[model samples]
Target: WAYPMQPIQSAAMSGIGYSPIGPVEGTWVVGFFRDGENAQDPVMLGTIGGIPQNFPGSDGFNDPNQVYPLSNLNFHGLGEPDTNRLARTIGTDILGRDSKEHPVVTQKLSTTPLFDESTGTPIPYPGVPIESEGGDIRRIPKALAEGNFWVEPPTDAPFTP
Candidate 1:
């Protein structure tokens, strides 16, 4: 079954799992299905570790020093309500630099297909223009699709002097 690409902000754990590059606050049970497989046939994709249980209340986990509950954290289950807030938190945690001082993440298109709601047939997702030549729409065939986790900064892109 082909899964449509959703922006990192709103996509389910499957698409997001392929990238595996952000903060998720709860332990997640991600499920995966083979192409053309029934939704009921999903195989275990394994679990994601959420915020440590012991994290202090100020940081928002149940306890600053214990392992956190695998199901209760909202950010892990639903994501930050505001992308900016998510961006800033991840920016600080992953890069150790201020989100204001550097670009947090770059958006890219994926060739995953969104299935028809009722018939379950694959359908092309609407396209959007991007700064690059072809715009942000991903046009590659899903069988040959590849996911990129790195960004190439321009020669003039800002850097610490």
Candidate 2:
């Protein structure tokens, strides 16, 4: 059986710079997973990884000539936006290979993923807050790490070690 499914949205960011500190190039990865108990697991839904974009003020990298990829994990604002603010992006880029075997880019912007400041609950599937002591939040990661949520030998390599 087959049916179209809405992409499950997830994002990870790095190399963020703001204010007196100039901007650095940033990258993000979005993953789509099937719905179910194994939603955290892969259900044939693939992941888009290593997408690149620049910080607010930089064309590419703050140090474009640097020999290695720079990381800016300094954004301290996740829940405290008033205390610390950061820049972000949201959209979709469909990647594929054409007849000539070249990459194709198709970008679409639908709804934006907004954080619910109204709720204090940390997302419960990935892991515990590390501040709390127990619950599915604590058990889920250990289970996933041991291959319980999804089938063994995930279709795609596990992103975490």
Q: Estimate each model's TM-score.
A: 0.22, 0.18
lDDT of 1 by residue, 1-161 (tens): 53343333232321122222332333244567764455666564544432233323554333344433222212232232222222222321212212434533344344468899999999865432112111111222344335522333344444332
What lDDT does each candidate get?
A: 0.33, 0.28
Give candidate 2 misplaced runs (Cα > 4 Å).
1-67, 70-87, 99-101, 106-109, 112-161
Q: What lDDT tens digits, residue by residue, belong to model 2 across residues 38-128?
A: 6786443322223234323446423345411333222222232211111232213323334333445534332344445688544323321
Q: Which stretches of candidate 1 lie over 4 Å from their true place?
A: 1-17, 22-25, 30-45, 48-122, 126-141, 145-161
Clashes of each: 14, 1
Single out the weakest 10-residue window by summed lDDT for candidate 1: 129-138
The per-residue C-alpha lDDT of model 2 at residue 90 equals 22
